[model samples]
Target: MSAPKQDAWVGHLGPAGFDLRSDTMTTPTASMLAAIQSCSLLDDVFVEDPTTIELESHVAELAGKEAALLVLSGTMGNQLALRSLLTQPPYSVLCDHRAHIIKYEAGGFVHSFCLS
Candidate 1:
C-alpha cells in the first residue's frame, strides 16, 4: 500500500490544518501584536496587572469561584487548583488519564509543586 496523496485544495491545509508536527506555523496576526503593544502592563506578582486581573475576574465570574488565579495555560491552572486542594503531603492528584497536564508540559507542575 502507498501513502495517500494530500489534495492541494483539501479542507485541511495551511492555517486551517495547524500542523503541530512542524515548527513552520503561522505567527499571531498584526491586530494581536498591536493589542500586545498597546496593552498596559503592571506588576503581575502582586495581582496589579490590569489584563491579568481582568482575565482572573472573568474566569472567576464564569466558573462561579470565590477567586481565580490567572495561570499561563490550562495545565498550569489545573495543577495549581489540585495543589491548593491537597492539604496534607504525598499529594497525588487525580485527573483524566490522557489529560495534557499528565502527558505534556515537561513536568512543569511536578517540579514546581513536588507532586507525587
Candidate 2:
C-alpha cells in the first residue's frame, strides 16, 4: 500500500493550535523571557533604553543607514514610513482595496496625513 501524502495531513500548529485566524497568537520562549528579565528596563519615552538603542544601531548598520527606530507593530511601522515620506497634506496612497492597512487600520494613515 502507498504511504499517506504529507499534504493530506493537517500540518503542525502555527502559534495557536488549529486556529489560523490571526498571526498574533504567539508565546514567548524561555530565552525571550530570560532576556526580558535580565535586560535593562527603562521608560523609552523619557530615556533612551540601552538595549533598544543597541538593536536599532545594529539594524542601521545592517541596512547601511545612520539610524533606525523600532516600532511595536506592522501598523506603526507603516504609519511611520508614510508620515516620513508623505511630507505634505492632500496626498493619496494606493493599495489593494481590501488591504489591511486600508480596511483594518481604521483610516489611521488616511486621517493622520489628510489623504483623500
Candidate 3:
C-alpha cells in the first residue's frame, strides 16, 4: 500500500494563517505615524506652513514652473492644473479614456471645471 498522503486542506488563511483580502487587518508603521505628526497644521491656500511650502517648491521644481500649489489628490491636482491653464471656464479638458478623474471622480471635472 502507498504511504499515507496529506489531504487537500487549507493551512492558514481564514483557518490557516493570514488572509490579505480581509479588511479587519493592517497597522500603520511607526514611520507613517511620525510623518503624520510632523506635518504642520496650516492653511495651504495661503502657503503658510513650512511643510506645505517645501512640497510646493518641490512640485514647482519638478514641473519646471515658477510655483506650484498643493491639492488633496491626483484627481484634484489634475483638475486644478486644468483650471489654472484655462482662465475662463468651458474650456476643453483632454484626458485619456481610462484616466482616474475621467472614470472615478464622479463627473467632478465636467461639472466643476467646465461649468465654473
Candidate 4:
C-alpha cells in the first residue's frame, strides 16, 4: 500500500487523542486508511464481500466455532451476543455498570432481554 500523505489526517492526534474512555475515539492510522481504500465495495449482506467473509472465517476458526457473523457496529454485536445467550425469557446479564452497552446502547439489553 502507498504511504499516507504527510498532511493526511491519518496520524494526526485530534481532540480525542488522549481520551481513553471509549474505543470510538480511536484515530485511524495510515495502514488502516490504505486498507479501507483497497477494500471491496461488494455488499456484505449478500455475502459478496471477500474481506468481510475472510475476516469472519478467520475469527470463527480462532474461536473454534463453525461460523461467525460480522455485524455493522458494537451495538449490533452486543445485541446478537445477548440474543444468542439469552434464548429464553427472564434473562439476566451481569456486566459492569460503566460498560458501553449499559451507558450508550439506549437500554437495548434491558428492553430485549430483561423485559422479554
Estimate the TM-score of every prediction: 0.56, 0.71, 0.57, 0.70
Deviation in angstroms for 44 in model 3? 2.9
Per-residue lDDT of 114 in model 2: 64
Report model 3's TM-score to 2 decimal places. 0.57
Error of 4 at 95 (Å): 2.5
Candidate 4 stretches with Cα past 4 Å from truth are 1-23, 113-116
At residue 50, give the lDDT of candidate 2: 90
Span of ten consecutive residues with least summed lDDT in model 4: 4-13
Q: Global lDDT for candidate 4?
A: 0.79
> Higher-TM-score candidate among 2 and 3?
2
lDDT values, one for every candidate:
0.68, 0.73, 0.69, 0.79
Models, CA RMSD each? 7.2, 6.6, 11.4, 7.5
Clash pairs detected, candidate 2 = none
Model 1, runs deviating above 4 Å: 1-27, 89-91, 94-97, 105-116
What digit string (tens of lDDT, one per residue) describes model 4 on residues 21-56? 345656667898899999999998889989999999
Candidate 3 regions with alpha-carbon error over 4 angstroms: 1-28, 87-90, 113-116
List model 1 lDDT by residue over 1-116, tens digit each. Answer: 56444432232454445433322344556776898899988899976789988888898999999878766656666667767787677767677878777688677667867655
RMSD (Cα, Å) of candidate 3?
11.4
Candidate 4 clashing pairs, residues 3+ apart or interchain: none
Per-residue lDDT tens digits for candidate 3, residues 51-90, read: 8899889989999999887766677776777677878745
User: For candidate 4, what's the RMSD?
Assistant: 7.5
Q: Comparing 3 and 4 by TM-score, which wins?
A: 4
TM-score of 1: 0.56
